[model samples]
Every structure is written in C-alpha cells, then in structure tokens.
Target: MPHTTVLPFKALLLDMDGTLVNSDAVVERCWREWALEHGLDPAEALKVVHGRQGYATMAVLLPERPMELNHADNKVMLAKETADTEGVVPIGGAPAFMAAVADLPHALVTSADEKLAQARMGAAALPMPATRVTAELVGASKPDPEGFLKGAAELGFDPADCIVFEDSGAGIEAGKAAGMRVLGVGPRAAEHAPTAVVADLTQVRVVTDADGSTSLHVTV
Candidate 1:
C-alpha cells in the first residue's frame, strides 16, 4: 500500500473521461475514424483529442475547415461516440470512490457534451453527479477553468473550497486555474504539476464528518 495523506476540503469537482469514466477505447476509435475521414494523421489526432471538447479538438486539428463543417463533423463524431460502447468501464476504484462521496458535495466537470457524457457514463454504469458542467454548459473546456469553475459554482462552493480529481494535463490545469487543489489521476498526470497525484481514484478515499464536512484521504 502507498502512503496516504489526509486532506480536508469542502467539495469535489471531477473530470469525466479519464477521471470518473473510462471511455478511452471508444474515444480513440471515434477520433481515429474521424481522422481517417479527414485525411489527418491518426496518431497526431489522437494525441490532441483527449481531455478536449470534440469541436475544440476539431478546430485545433483542422483549422482550415469551415466553422460550419466543423460543427457538422463534431455532431457526427458525437453520434458515433454515443452509439459505441464496446469497452467503456469505470476507472479502477472509481465506483468505490464515488460511493464514498455519495453524501458529499461534488460535481462532474467534463469536456464532453451532454450526449457524450450520458452515453459514456451510462455505458460505464457510473452514477451521475447531481451537479455537472458539461460541454453544452460551458463556452470553454478544460485548461480554461470554465468548466471547473462552473462545477464549483453549481455545487454552491467557492472554487478555492473545492478539490478536483482529473486525469489529463488539461483537466489538471483547469482545476488549478479554478483555484482548487487538484489530485492528478493517472501516471501521465504527474507531468502537469497538480497539487498531488494518484495512480487512480482507488488511491483516495472520501470521508464525511458529522458536521457534514468532507475530506479526502489520498495514498500518494
């Protein structure tokens, strides 16, 4: 077992894809297929797609494409992602972690649109947070602080009072930018300089006090 540290915090803000839901296989497949359709490099496309909104990724990769075309293509990609769920699953320990926080204040913050969020999370059999900041609700995505900020707002907590769990560099950046201490999820997250990093949600546990305060105990 890794060393665990106990940190008290007011609330949690989580990113969906790599943070709460495991949909990498389906995400990759959709993006790879879209890459081939657009004559783009699949490797490069995959590299930039994760932790980003579909339209934003499309905008970055196919800058020359018209906005209208990007919108249409993004819709197509969203449909494809929603319709496919061959390998969607919860990140190891995700279910347990979620159960621990069931009575605490928390929200889902993700770069995915509502439809994609519903599809992926549904496929993973994960419970949805009552408060959510989805792509459709925010003008900007991860690394911009928009979604995380929105999440904190929806949870009725100040950004600084929240702790975030995220698996991507962009998501970590967004959390920090929102003024929340972040627990970087996954090995790759270490490079992003989050407040702390953990192997997965399993490495952390949530506790609720009798006074209704919540804290996270993390195994670093």
Candidate 2:
C-alpha cells in the first residue's frame, strides 16, 4: 500500500536531467571521457556532475583550475553532449505526467543551454516548455538558486507558490534556497531530503481544480 500526499502549488519549476528525462547514459559517457582527459577519477567526477552546468561541475572537480578554462571546456563538453543523444529517454511516467501539466503554469529551469536542452528533450520525446531559463539565461548554476528564482519570477509566481521537481542534490538545494517546495525524483535526490520524495514520476499525479488550481498527489 502507498501513502499518498497532496501538495498544492501555483506553478512548477522543472529540472531536465534525471527529472523528466534520463540522460545518464549519455552524461556518463561524456563525463567519463572528460574526467580521464583531466586525470580525475571518473567515479568522483560523476558524483558531482548531475544538476549542474558543465562549467560548474568542472569547477567542483578541479577546484584549482582556472575559471576561464572551465568555461571554455564546458563549451566543448556541451557540443559533445548535444551531438550524442543515443540513449536519452524519458523517466518513468514522464510522458503522461508531462501531458497532465501541459496546460499548467510551468517553466523549465535547467543547467543545459537551449541547444543541448532541445536535443535531449527531443531525444526523449518530451515536449519542451515555452517558459524556460536555460544556462545562457542564468549567471549561476544549480545549488546557487538563481535559475529557480528567475523561473518563479518568469512564471509570475512567488517562490513559495512554486513546486520544483528535481533529482539531484544541487537542484534540490537550489529549489530549497529559492524557497520552493521540492519534490525529489529518483535515487539521487533521496539523500537530499526534499520536501517530498518519489521513486519516479509514476508516484506523482497532477490534478487541476475547477478554479484552475493545480495540485500534485504524490505517493512517497
């Protein structure tokens, strides 16, 4: 038996990787190569990769590296990631969940730039939201809260009125920092203690009220 919980919000702020889409196959493949090139352990690099822009991840893994180098290398990594979407796919129940929120107030707040975001979403067969705050739009990455804050503002909702869906520590931290209730998705997010936790989107059901209010009935 599953204990269901209902969480209400005026808008949604969504994270792409590990949330709506599972790009781990491609992500791991690319990051592994990058880690080896930089003489860092691939396993350690992977531990810091999710929910961040490429440059941010690099900075974490290579704290002594120049910021400019990280930025320049991030461009190459982005191109490589964008060019390879061989294994990109939607998370469980993501397709239906997406449709349920299609008409709702939602914005994509992702670390990936527009091109990479499009490539991954297209590969996963997920519909891209019209309101998006991509990497280029944010001066900082996840764990900094800037992207989530901007997302809430763009959707005309206060942070407290927005619900974030994420699957990584950095994203969960960002959502929390922005004062939003976060619904953690997937294994990675469980460690972060989000407002709610779900194994996947299958555990979540979105409902729209007569007054146009939206609520997520989540089975933790």
Candidate 3:
C-alpha cells in the first residue's frame, strides 16, 4: 500500500492523457514523426506536445507557419492519434478511482479532440465521463484554463470546489488557473508544484455522500 492523504472536496476534474490513461508511446511516436517531417527537434516536440492540443504544439514549434498549415497539420495529427491506440491503457488505479467517482460531480477534461479522447479512453477500457470537456469543446487548451473551467461548469461545480487530477505541468497550471486545487500525478509532473502530488490514482479513493458532496481519500 502507498502512503496516503485525504482531501475533502465537492467535485473532481480529471485530465485524460498521462493522468487517467497511458498513451505515451502513441503520443511520442506521432510527435516524433511530425517533428521529423517538419525538421524540428523531436525532443522538444515531445516536451511540448504531451499536455497540449496538436495545433497549440504546432503553433509553438512553427510560429511562422500559416494558420491554415497548422490547422491542416492538426487534422492529420488528430486522425492519426484517433486511429492509433497502440500502448494506450489506464494509469494505475484510475479505473477504480473513476468508478468510485461515478456518482460524484466529476468531469474528464482533455487536450485531445473528442474523437481521439473517445478512442484513447476506449483503448484503456475506461468509461468516458458524461461531462467531458475536450479540445473540440474548448476555446483554448491546457496552460490556458479553458478546458478545466469548462469542466467545472459542465459538472455544475465552482472551480474552488473541484479537485483536479493532472499529470503534466501544463495541466497543473491550467487547473490552478481555473482556481481549483490540483493533485499532480506522475514523476514528470512533480516539478510543477501542484496542490498535492501523487504517483497515480491507485492511492486515491472517492467518497460520495448522501447529499451528493464528495471527498477524496488519497494515498500520497
């Protein structure tokens, strides 16, 4: 058993990739291919792509490129990501944590478009949350707070009442910017200084109350 901590919050906001699902292999593969094709650095490409929308990543990597070019490239990246589910799986304890939160106010907020979100979540055999805020639903991506804010609204909770689970620096920043407490997941995410950090949801359990309030018993 992992060391644990308990946080009482009324709602939950979850990041899909790296946070709930493991799709690093497919993500890195796609980004590397895109970098090679564009003569950019694959290392840097992977660094910025993990928690951002494809178009956002492309915009940073090739700022001088036309919007049409980046949009078109994003479509290609989206299609490839949707079609490639290789290595996609649930992060440790994510499924169980999700199950425990099924009755609580919770939302899945993702950088991936709707199609890719469904594909990857399906690949991981995790049920997609009904209140999902995807790239297609947001005006901006991670590090912008749009997705997490949308999630909080969709779940009918104030951002202050939500505890966000994220596995990337961009995601942690987004959550904080949305005025929520964030629980960082994964080693790569620790440097971002989330409200609290955990290895994965394996140590976290949701407690749903009769009044519909929820709290998290987390193993730190």
Candidate 4:
C-alpha cells in the first residue's frame, strides 16, 4: 500500500484549469488558433500557456509585442474560450473533492477572469467556491504570486496556514512564492517541484479536526 502524506492547513487555494477542471481541449483549440494566427509555433506557445492569463501568455510568446495589444487579444481570446465549453470536464475525483471542501475555507484562484472561471467550472459541473481571486482581481498573474496571496487574504488565512492545489508550473511557483504548501494535481505538475503531488483527487482525503482545522491526507 502507498503511504499517505498528511499536510495540514487552515485554508485551501485551488487553481481551475488542469487542476480542478480539465479544460485542455478548449484551451488547446483557442490557444492553438491564436498562436497560428500570429505566426507563432503552436507547440511552443502552449508550453507557457497553461498557468497564465491570456495577456501574460501572449507577452511571453511575443516579448516585443506591446502590452496593450496583448491585453486586447486576451479579451478576444477570453470571449472565445468562454463561449466554447464543449470539452470541459472535471478532473478525476474533482467533484468529490469539491464537495468535500464545499463548506471549508477554500477559494478558486485562477488566471481566468470571473466569466471564464464560471463557464469552465459550470461546464465541468463543479460547484464554485464562494471566495475566488480571478484575473480581474489581480494586478499581476501567476508566477508573480498576486493571485495566491489575494486568495489567502480573502480566506482570512495567513499564507503559511494555507495549502495550494495546482497543476501548472506557474501556479506551483505562485503558491510557493505565497509561502503556502502546494499539492500538485496531475501529470503536468510532476516537474514543477510542488511540496507534494497526487495523481488525482482520488489519492487525496480531506480531514477536518474537532476544532475545525483542515488537513489533506494525500497518497503520493
């Protein structure tokens, strides 16, 4: 039997895409189209696309492009993504995990704006967390730590008292930068050096103490 790893925390911060919801199909469709339209390599663009807001991903792929232009393109891309939820679905064990934490101190911190976040989560049939830090709420994107920090603050927990669940390089880095322990959620998160990793939410069990503190029992 695999040993279980217990990680304690007062709050939880979750990333949407590639973590709670598997929106890879829609993500690939939108981004690949955008990349090809701009004469960039689709393969290369996708590497930096998983964990960032559209503008941030564009800035990385086209460093010479003006920030305003990236922002404009991001707006269009967000609309396209929001409108296409044809392939969105919950990650393995995500529905049960979300339900387990529904009344706990948890928040969704994603690169997606409010509408996109809602669309994807709704498409995946996952219940949305009441506290969330979306794109519009942050001045900077993941890998900058702004979103995670804001999520911790909104949940009334100190960074060290929070545990972040993520599946992207940028999201892992952002969680670490915010001083929270991170639980990487899938194949994509393996190389990111998260504090711990689980193949899926199936390998995880959430426990609430008599005092109401929460801890995750993860099978690594």
Question: What order do candidates take by lDDT, descending?
Answer: 2, 4, 3, 1
The TM-score measured for candidate 3 stands at 0.94
- Model 3 misplaced stretches (Cα beyond 4 Å): 1-3, 209-213
The candidate scoring highest on lDDT is 2
Q: Report the poorest 10 consecutive residues by lDDT, candidate 2.
A: 211-220
Per residue, candidate 1 scores C-alpha lDDT tens digits across 31-133 of 9888998899999998778787888788899898787888788788888888998999999899998888877888988887888888888888888988888
* Each model's lDDT: 0.85, 0.95, 0.87, 0.94
Measured on C-alpha atoms, candidate 4 has an lDDT of 0.94
Candidate 2 stretches with Cα past 4 Å from truth are none
Tens digit per residue, CA lDDT, model 2, 8-91: 999999999999999999999999999999899999999999999999999999999999999999999999999999989999
TM-score of 1: 0.94
- Which residue pairs of candidate 4 clash? none
Q: What is the per-residue lDDT of model 3 for residues 11-107, given as tens digits with 9 covering 90 to 100?
A: 7888999999999999999889999999988998888887888888889889998878988999999999899999999999988887887877888
Number of the candidate with higher TM-score, 1 or 3: 3
RMSD of each: 1.5, 0.7, 1.7, 0.8
Order of models, best TM-score first: 2, 4, 3, 1
Candidate 3 least-lDDT 10 residues? 211-220
Residue-level error in angstroms, candidate 1, position 209: 3.9
lDDT of 4 by residue, 47-151 (tens): 999999999999999999999999999999999999999989999999999999988899999999999999999999999999999999999999989999999
